[model samples]
Target: MSPLIELRGVTKSYGDHTVLRGIDLEVAAHEVISLIGASGCGKSTLLRCVNGLETIDGGEIAVDGDVVSGPGVDLVRLRRQVGMVFQSYNLFPHMTVLQNAVLAPVKTGLCSKEEAEERAMAMLGRVGLADRAGSYPDQMSGGQQQRAAIARTMLMSPRILLLDEITSALDPELVIEVLNIVQDLAESGMTMLLTTHEMGFAREISGRVCFLHGGGILEQGPPAQIFDDPAEQRTRDFLRKVSLAGRL
Candidate 1:
């Protein structure tokens, strides 16, 4: 069977600066892949490209064999299949957590309000946030807010999830709570593509780990090979820096 997601010679740029240069990747069903690199190495950009948030400058990106990065793509339908969570919890400040989670499904006519609420509540419970369903965004902690955002995305029943530094905005002590939710999703066989700074968690959770450099994949392998026995000198250098910073 074909991969669930595929990118072939994908390229992206802003003005004169290229963010992704001829990247080729494939994500199989139920696989969890982690993208690790220095800041601005194009990990987040790649995710955006896949979800049709940013148009690619060259090559192709396909989800379930349907081209999504080029012209004439049905972006709204594409987004329904691809859920993304960012570092910032972009929850509506005035909306209650449950309201925020259910809005998309209701607005898109994907489900009735009652149905949306039921799914929203169940997803909130899954993320350990059912108790906070009636709370506003400002009333919750960063971790709680992020978890609510995850619940909101999950309510859409997306085929794949893209997480972009989801824990980077939280306090150190609060990061684990959010990571635990993601860990649970991984164990439940979610197809995920994540860009993360948490190397240890990536090593522990990812089925495959990719090292990105200069807008390209410098190396990729199982977590053990990428973390413990990297092949490329650039990969080793990056890991060494992460180690010195006590982040690996």
Candidate 2:
């Protein structure tokens, strides 16, 4: 079977500072992958590129056998199939949680307002935000807001999920609740590609772990091999620093 997501020789840059350089990867259906590395290593950019938020400079990216890179691609369509959750909860401040969750489906004509609300409520309930449906973004804690953002993304029934350091902005105490939700998604066989600093959670939940370094994926393998016995020197050094910092 074709990979659910495919990137070949992908490259991206902002002026001269390239973020991703010839990044190639393949993810299968229901596979969970974690991209781990220091900041500015293109983890977030890679996800953005895949979801059509950032255009690539070179190479090709395909989702489910259809090309998604370069010009003329239907970004809205691409994003619907490949959902993304970012570090910041970008909810509409004026909208209540239920309103925010239903925006995409209703705006895109995917469903009527009533249908969207029902679907959004179910997703909000799944993310443990049932009680917050009537609350605005400012009324919720950081964790709760993030959960609402996740529920908003999931309401579209995306085929693949891209998570970009979803826990970095939250207080440490609130991190567990968000990670628990992601763990539940992983266990439910959601296809995911996530950039994360939560090493332990990534190791515990990812089917495969990829170490991104110097604008490319330096090494990737099963979690045990990548974490315990990685093949690349850079991967070893990176893990050592993470270990020393008590992040691994």
Best by lDDT: 1
- Global fold similarity of model 2 (TM-score): 0.97
What is candidate 1's CA lDDT for residue 79? 90
lDDT of each: 0.94, 0.93
| Candidate 1 all-Cα RMSD | 0.8
Model 2 C-alpha RMSD to native:
1.0
Candidate 2 on 132-239: residue-level lDDT in tens?
A: 899999999999999999899999889999999998899889988998898899889899999988788789779999999999999999999998999999999988
Q: Residue 53, candidate 1: how far off, in angstroms?
A: 0.7
TM-score versus the correct structure, for each prediction: 0.98, 0.97
Candidate 1 lDDT, 1-248, residue by residue in tens:
99999999999999999999999999999999999999999999999999988999999999999888877998879999999999998999999999999899999999999999998888999999889999999999999999999999988889999999998898889988988999999999889999998898799779999999999999999999999999999999999999998779
